[model samples]
Target: MRFERCRMLFGDEDFEKIQSSKILILGIGGVGSYALDCLYRSGVTDITILDFDIYDESNRNRQIGSDAVGESKVDTLAYLYPGIKTINQRMDMAWVADFDFDPYDIVIDAADTTKVKIEVAKKCYKKLIMALGSAKRYDASKIEVASIWKTHGDALARKIRNELKKAKFDRNFLVVFSPEEDKCKEKGSCVAVTGAVGLTVCSEAIKRILK
Candidate 1:
């Protein structure tokens, strides 16, 4: 079955295949939450979210729900998207390493910790991963990944990617959530910026899949 909303873009074959491909999202913050909505509309029916954070009042700044106060954020996501599968636990490589899971076709990283990003990359090196996948996609337009991307889709990323290719550094999606000048931790932000990043993440995901 097709979600009418995405009918304008995803047609028969792409939608069908995408619906079957399992997606594992690693964060549930503002960016991840927004990206989830995009994923749902895009017809990715099987989604697994892993986050260990509980709702807080401060999250009202950009998180999915303020009413979810004290509730497990992942739990809230599962409820909003009924068919979604969720694992509410802090992601550690050990959790993934010891588990028996079908090799996920894609991994979306939106977790808050840099450690989580590195760990997830190590844990799921075999599949095609997406930028900093999912939530991390938000804020990436200006968020630099170690001077690689001065702005979103900058040339340095291309340079590094080419070097990695030459060195055969296992091909994987390395998306960065760029921090905008105004939203810099040096600055501050609202949901608008967070949403921008989430949509961008989904946009990149679609583009990659189309390519």
Candidate 2:
């Protein structure tokens, strides 16, 4: 009954695919959390979340379920969404080089670090939907989903593009980005924008799975 509406919308075969697809989400911040929420609520049960950071008082403003300060983000998420897997480790170049991504049907990159995003783009380009710079913005309506090369106005996306080019990443991958100008210099976040970005990323993943 939980996914009755989703089942109605997607039909039985596609709904089954959505439920069975293996999804990997990198980062458990504002964007990733909402993406995971959208996926799970849509009947996508098999999800693996990866994050190295612990919840902080500052996270309460934007992050979902940020009640436990100093607690592992992955652990808290796993607790909140039982049956989903959790990896509570930082994604670095070394780990990225060694890890195998063949098992996952889609990889969502909501990570804050450019290095990790580039590495993920290289390794998971065929099945990646990355989030580009959700912070320091306010307008949720400005969010757009496009290939990384076509993205503009996001400094983080620019940096990732440069790194990916230098790394000889020739494949194109979809990304959720906002073209709105930053409100200030400081890295601040609003759930309105980040949540919209996250939901957009999830929507892209759903489209891919249905295809």
Best candidate (score: lDDT):
2
Off by over 4 Å in 2: none
Candidate 1 lDDT score at position 111: 67
Per-residue alpha-carbon lDDT of candidate 2 for residues 84-186, written as tens digits (9 for 90 to 100) = 9998888998988988999999999998878878888888799999999999999999999889999998888898888878878779999999989999889
Name the runs in model 1 displaced over 4 angstroms: 99-102, 125-172, 182-187
Using Cα atoms with residue i matched to residue i, what is each candidate's TM-score against the true structure? 0.74, 0.97
Reference-based TM-score, model 2: 0.97
lDDT of 1 by residue, 27-97 (tens): 77877787788888788888888788889887887877547899999888788888998887877767757
**Candidates' C-alpha lDDT:** 0.63, 0.91
